[model samples]
Target: MKKIILLLTLITLVFSSMPVNEAVAKSKYKKISVSATAYNELGRTATGFDYRKHPTAKAIAVDPRVIPLGSKVYVPGYGYAIARDVGGRIKGKIIDVHFKTRKQAIKWGRKKVKIRIYRK
Candidate 1:
């Protein structure tokens, strides 16, 4: 609907407005160790990221206090994604990576990995 488009547009604007010295991705990120989990649920996210709707969009749920919303994060096994969602259980030093399928989410399971966070 119009709301979805507007939300996506607003989120894009917010994420794009971040200040980064390096244009190349993963160049200016703060590396940190955290517990990473996976999820493939279809619902409304805290930041309005709907995997069912925008399946191709890379997104992650993070603790806003720790990683902040709109931050670009790079996972070890996974590729780069944006911190476009938040979860109640996702507290400090923990993150939830979004996958397209439950099988993929289950496959990912849980792991302790070093992630690169790019503030924006």
Candidate 2:
């Protein structure tokens, strides 16, 4: 009857709309060092950097295959970071923490810190 046809059609539509994971792939998880920096308030005026731009002590680099670019990460010692850049200077599982001032950056300089990757 009409009711039976409508139910089947709705079911088919729902299933078809479900996400197929063929195109996008998941990143492999890994633990790595992370650093922190605190940026000056002036640096954040133009682009809303305070909220969006990586925090001065919040920028970090990660292995692209392991963490991917633009991923949010939390550091055990330093706090939160966004994987923004890859470094020739930084190799293996190392991460560079950014800060607003030289003093703040230096305060956190070159510490071995654990990082947790936040999956979106």
TM-score of each: 0.74, 0.52
Per-residue C-alpha lDDT of model 1 across residues 52-73, encoded as one tens digit per residue: 7888677899999999898888
Off by over 4 Å in 2: 1-30, 33-57
| Candidate 2 structure quality by residue, lDDT tens digits, 1-120 | 999999999999999998877435544445665443333232432213342354434666555766677778887766777776655555566666655666876676666667777764
Report how far residue 31 has shifted in candidate 2, in Å.
Answer: 3.8
Scored by lDDT, the top model is 1
- Pairs of residues at least 3 apart in sequence or in different chains that clash in candidate 1: none
